[model samples]
Target: MIVTIDGPAGAGKSSAARSLANRLGFRFLDTGAMYRAVVFAALEQGVELTDADALEQVAAQLRIELGDQSVLVNDQDVTRAIRTQAITSATRYAADHPGIRALLVDQQRAAAAGHECVTEGRDQGSVVFPDAECKVFLTASERTRGERRYHDLIARGEQVTLEEVLEKQRERDERDTTRAVGALIQSSDAVVLNTDGMSPDEVVDRLYEIVQQRRVAK
Candidate 1:
C-alpha cells in the first residue's frame, strides 16, 4: 500500500508523513529531497539552474539513494549538504524542468515498487503516485507556515528575519504552483486537511485514523 501526502513547505507534511510511516511500520520517501539532490548535482557540475537541457542531462546521469532517514548521491552522504540556501533556491528551478521531472518520477516509482511506503512532496499525490491508496493534502495559512519556517531556520542557526522567511516562502509558493511540470496541486480525490492550528501528534492521529478506515473499507 502507498499513502501520499501533498502539501506546501512548512505545513508539517514531512514530520507528519514520517511519523505516520513509523507508526505503520512502513518505509518513507521524501520526494522533495530528490529535487534537492538534482539541484545539488547541478551546482557541482556548474550547470545553470535555468539551463533546462544541461540540468536535464545532469539529472539523467545523477545517482541518488534514499535510505531509512538519510539521502545519498553517488554513494556520498548528502543528508545535510542539499539543505543549503543555494540548493534550496535552485530546487524549484530544477524540479520545474519537464525532462528532469520525468527521469526523477521514474526513479521514485521504482523506489516504491513493492513496499508499503508513505511518500510526501508537493506533487506526490497529483503526479508521482496518483493511484496511491490514500492521498492527503495538508494546508495551513501563510502566516502560520512562515512562522514555522522562521523558527525552523533559527533552530538550524541560520540568521534569518521573519520578513525574509515570509518573502522566501511566498516566492516558493508561487513557483511551486506555477511551475510547468508536476505543478503543486491537490489531487481531485485527496482528503484536504487544514492544519493551521493542529499539533503534529493530532495531525498524525487523524491521518492514521483515516488510513485505518480506508484499509477496513478495502
Candidate 2:
C-alpha cells in the first residue's frame, strides 16, 4: 500500500509521515527532498536556478538516495546541505519545472513499486500518487504554520526572523497553489486533516488508524 501525506510547509507532514511509516513498517519517501537535492546540486555546479534546461539536465543525471534522514547526491552525503536557506529558496524553481517534476515523479513511482511507502510532499496525493490507497492532506492555520516554521529554522540556526519566515511561507503557498504543473492541491478522494492543535504523535496515530481503515475497505 502507498500512503501519501500531502501538505504545505510546517504542517508536520514529515514528522507524522515518518512515524506512520515506522508504525506500519513502510518505507518513507520524501519527494520534496528529491527536488531539494537537485537544487543543491545546481548550486554546487554553479547552475542558474532559472535555467530550466540546465535544471532538467541536472535532474536527469542526479543519483539521489534518500535514507531515514540522509540525502545522498551523487555519492556525496548532502543531507544537511540541501536544507540550507540558499538551496531551500532555489528548490521552488527546481520543483516547479515540468521536465524535472516528470523525471522525479517517475523515479518516485519506481521506488515504491515493490514496497509499501508513506510519501510526503506538496503534490504526493494530487500528482505523484493519485491512486494511493490512503491519501491525506494535512493543514494548519497560517499563523500556526508560520510559528512552527520560525521555530524550526531557528533550531537549525538559520538567521531568519519570524516576519521573514511568515512572508516566505505566504509566497510559497501562493506559488505552490497557483503553479501550472504538480500544483499543491488536495485530491478529491483525500481526507483532510486540520492539525492546528494536534501533536505529531496524535496526528500519526490518527493517520495510522485511517490507513488501517483504508486497508480493510480495500
Candidate 3:
C-alpha cells in the first residue's frame, strides 16, 4: 500500500506523514528530502543551481539513503543539513530539472518496491505516485502556512523575517503550480484535508484512518 500526502510547503505534510507512517508501521518516503539532497550536494560541490548538466552528474553519483531517523547522501548524514532554510529556498533548481527529477523519482520507486510506505511531497500524488492506493491533499490558509514556516525556520536558527518567509512562500507556491514537470497539483481523486486549526496528532490520526479504510477497500 502506498499512501501519498501532497500539499504546498509548510503545510505540515512532513510531520503528519512521518507520524502516519509510523502509526501504520510503514516506511516513510520523504520525497522533498530526495530533491533537497541533490541541492545540498550541488551546493557542497559549488555547482550552479541552474546548471542542469552538473546537477544531473551530482545526482547520478550520489548515494542518497533515507532511513526512518536519518537521511544519508554519499555516506554523509544530511538529515538536518537538507532541512535548512537554504536548502528549502534552493530546492526548486533541482526539482525543476527534468533529468534530476527523473533520477529522484526512480530512486523513490525503488525505495518503495515490495514495501508499504507513506510518501509526502508537493507532487507525489500528481506526479511521483499517481497510482498510490490512497491520495491526500493537505492544505491550510496561506498565512497559516507561512506562519508555520516562519516559526520552523526561526527554531532552526535561520535568520528570516515573517514577511520574507511569506513572500518566499508565495513565490514557491507559484512555481510549484507552474513547474513544467512534477508540478504540484491536487489530484481529482485525492481527499482534501483543511488543517487550519488541527493539531499535528489529529492530522496523523485522520491520515491513519484514511489509509486503513483504503487498505480495507482494496
RMSD of each: 1.3, 1.0, 0.9
Per-model C-alpha lDDT, please?
0.88, 0.89, 0.91
Q: Candidate 1 residues 130-188, lDDT tens each?
A: 88999999989999999988887787778889998888889999999998888889999
Query: Which residue runs does candidate 1 get wrong by more than 4 Å?
Result: none
The local lDDT score (0 to 100) that residue 22 gets in candidate 3 is 89
Misplaced by over 4 Å in model 3 are none
lDDT (10s digit) by residue, model 3, range 135-158 = 999999999999999998889889
- Residue 140 shift from truth in candidate 2, angstroms: 0.6
Among all candidates shown, the one with the greatest lDDT: 3
lDDT at 95, model 3: 89
Winner on lDDT (2 vs 3): 3
lDDT of residue 46 for candidate 2: 93
Error of 1 at 94 (Å): 1.1
